[model samples]
Target: MKTDLYLDMDHLLLLLLLSSGLQAEGSLNQTDFVRLVDGNSLCSGRLEVKSDQSNQSWSSVCEDDFDQQDAEVVCRELGCGAPSVLQGALYGEGEAPMWTKEFQCGGNESALLDCRSSGSDRNTCSPGRAVGLTCSEPVRLVGGDSRCAGTLELKHEGEWRPVGESVDEWTLEEADFACRELDCGSAVSVRRQESSDRSVWSISYDCVQSGSLRECAASDNSSHWLNLTCSDFVRLVDGNSLCSGRLEVKSDQSNQRWSSVCEDDFDQQDAEVVCRELGCGAPSVLQGALYGEGEAPMWTKEFQCGGDESALLDCRSSGSDRNTCSPGRAVGLTCSEPESFRLMGGDSRCAGTLELKHEGEWRPVFDDYPFWILEEADIACRELYCGSAVSMRREESSHRSVWSISYDCVQYGSLRGCAASSYSSTILLSIICSGLLLQPKISASSSMDGVSEAKQQGLLVFRGSDFTVSCSIQPQYPGGSFELRFTSSTSAHTYTQPAVNHSAHFLFPAAEPAHQGSYSCVYHVHVFSHDFSSESRQLSLIVVDPRSDQIINNPSKIIITVVVLILLVSTASYFYFKQKDVTVPPTVGSVDLQHVQSW
Candidate 1:
């Protein structure tokens, strides 16, 4: 009983054992001994204290340096057993117990504790910083607390409230800061401060659901919400918005249909709900739809479009509205578009015609009708603003109605062509065309000039180009042959030139200085084809006498020179006659010479 012996299962075990019984027992049995160690050459294995594993487990100064000491201290404070008395960590020797040190919530010299749950956060030092709930003392919160997920009521003047009505997104930062500053664990409940007469700028916002306040609105305008710029989007019309926590829902109409409000977006939502209740959600395609939104009123077949950019087209065609097209002719098809669509005035057969459905008949809105009906029809066709048709309906015996127009829509031209029509209808109808209406619509058109506008400058102009002057639409000029008359105060009176080219520039010779005053060359434009001549722009040439004012009296110089020559000739002739016995000749000269000499 005093000696112990055992078999060596492995060679290493045999090598480790002693042969003698007492010696082997001493070698294998547990030994009770105490080893004192200095700070140097300490074995890596954890050294645990064999005392109450409280603060006293280690030297007060060495306590922070040992994991076992930390664990012992933490376990004791957490109501665990003595450090060495309890089973080591989990197993006796191999296990290294987990040591979690806690740091205080706030202090000038405190470490930030990584936390998980509320309990763990308060007691343990986690590896990662985890966000969780925190509660304020006294439990006075009515709306919410630091739960991070639950509702938090914000109280102003001792009244608790929910977060949404005045909440945008920034509620957490502002309210949380205020609450924590005020020592309320967190501002879980955020409510704007309200007043009996609230200024548009005074109401605060709360966004409990979103991550941030700016995220509630667009990034461009997030500050408005933070700054509480409610008035920027609101107005006080004889009263206030959200009076006594009740918002007003007023009713109005758009396109002759009732809606909750005038604003398109707001009213549209209300419209869907309201119209749905009235069993008028959206009309189905009766025939089909063809609408257009361009610079002018026109029809296009597009069934899958219902947008503000385009008018809702209600269209149908009967059999007769096919290839036979005329300006004021009736076709057996019709399309209902928006209000702003109008049939522009032009002389086009298929393209410019407007056909509306009256009594199941597609009638063209010609230039003859009251002009308003075709405009209204255009609106019905385009679902745009309604402008009166400039040309519609035919007084011709055929009594046809044509509705072809264009609109220059200024409001949405950047998105699409800007066109306008002023029409309204209680109900909208899609297009219904006759079998004859199978003819394709006229292709997109240019202006009435019938020329490519981009390439051609202005209208059909012939500047400095020759044009034969032959009469067609107009009667032959007076006596048939064209006459070019030149007139001016200085030029010949009514100087008539013959019939010439109808071009902008003329082949006529240059005018004399006398003819330069207000002399204009006007060619008749229409006169080339017709008897009535449209006058071309007057081409006037101004004659400027660059030097006439500077020539100082040339006529007097010529007269003086002639007088000097005559006197010299007379003097020479008198001297010769006196030598040749011309006393008689000298006598006459002497009478005038004597008076000069004697005087």
Candidate 2:
């Protein structure tokens, strides 16, 4: 009886110890033991740490002892993407006690406490030195060709799931938030795709008080998913400004890898897309390793952009894959910066009073030569991402300090780069551009599938399949003609159609190998007494023989098929022999009975 009682007491003590240990672990996990406070977002605030699991006392880390490596671990622990900014007292000084030890983090730790630390340096920290951090939001877009255009997904509870909401519930505000979170600029369009009920995360704009989607709720089953497209995705790096650098592309947001494109694989069309996506004027220079080779991995596939894509990732890639590139083969591009020159006080950006930004100040330009305004207006219009100058006029203004721009020097570069000096002039030159025409959209509809606008991998159709290429433009003009341009290695042909209801469809009853080529749409309209034309990005079509799929060309598939057939035959033979043995009666000398029973 005494033994039994002692054993019961030991078990009770073990249970108590385990219960307390579990409680401590639960508390540590619940609080993450670290937090950012007094900032606009959960990812940006004063950094506080709670090391002791036995108590809830929290302390702040001194910026003197903390560095970027330490900040990385904290951001990872908080489920943020990365640390973008780190400073002292950026949010505010916290009231908690200072952490005395210096954190020796290697920047790859999963949690802050997982890293090593130095001995205690001090008990009290100086004023206004509390660590403040701002981490990039953990948001991404998936299931699209590029990072900027895709189905919206957010990281929650260590898992990535698509956002779920009614189609009508989402607005431009929500879309813009998602685009900005991915660093893809502002939103241009949003689409809803209804699918079978599935588990997904739902975010409420109001609940996003911290600007973190972590606070959002997850729904068990939702049928609606959001697809968003942003205005820009490509960015330049390692050069003079945002307009020039080695090209790095973020095709997939899941891994967050920005890969460098090979110069041999990138072409002028691809350069055009990169410049346009960055909101620059045009491609001024493109060369191999011009800016400098990057440390990131080289992109596996070559970009075949149509030159009109809003983002680089929206372009198609080569079918053959090659990961290796020769040294100094990475593409470097330079785009003309368009931010310095603008036309203000006009109906649109294209039509406005010319203003030149010189030496950090925007000043009205007074053409020193009268013909300079008429001859060089095209230069200003092109820099502003508009067509050639259609008309120019002089507006009378009060005598004010203005820039006397030299048009002779403007032909070399932007108007701001021209020779200019301060001058008092009473005339401000204004110009109008051919901005009434919008780019026409080109889409292909096949018998096998529906219409698609941006086929990144290009469209593949079986031989003899029916397909139609359609062209449509936005409702800006009443009448315009659509020109379908087709180009191949051997030949080029164009088909024209009258635009009805602002759209035209070119039907092909049977697809042939000759039809395999690139197609684009050119919209031509006469408006404002000027002939204006805008072209859509190219669309690639491939006509393939369906019978090619029936042949088993892969050696692995052949081996797998032969192995499966052999296994099937062997199993059948074993069963057949066993049944025959059972039917036959056992004879005296037949040791087969024992052998069969063992088998």
Q: TM-score of every model?
A: 0.17, 0.37
TM-score of candidate 2 to 2 decimals: 0.37
What's the TM for model 1? 0.17
Write model 2 residue lDDT over 129-192, tens digit each, in one string: 9999887777777888777788888787888888876321454445656665666654545566
Give the C-alpha miss distance for residue 29 in model 2, angstroms. Answer: 3.7
Number of the top-ranking candidate, with TM-score as the measure = 2
lDDT of 1 by residue, 1-599 (tens): 11232222321242345333334432322111111122111111123321112222321111222233333333222222212211111212322232322222212211111111111212332322221111121112232232222332333222333333332223223444333322322222232333233212212332322222212221121122121111111111111111110111211111111111111112232222222221121322211111111111111111222223111112121232122222322111121221222222222221233444322234443321123344343433333222222323333334323322222211111101111111222222122111111111111111222222221111211122221111111222233222333455545433333443321212323223443322223323221132223232222222222233211222333443444455467777777887888674633342232111110
- Report lDDT (CA) for all predictions: 0.24, 0.71
lDDT of 1 at 38: 29
List ranges where model 1 is wrong by over 4 Å: 1-364, 367-401, 404-511, 523-534, 538-599
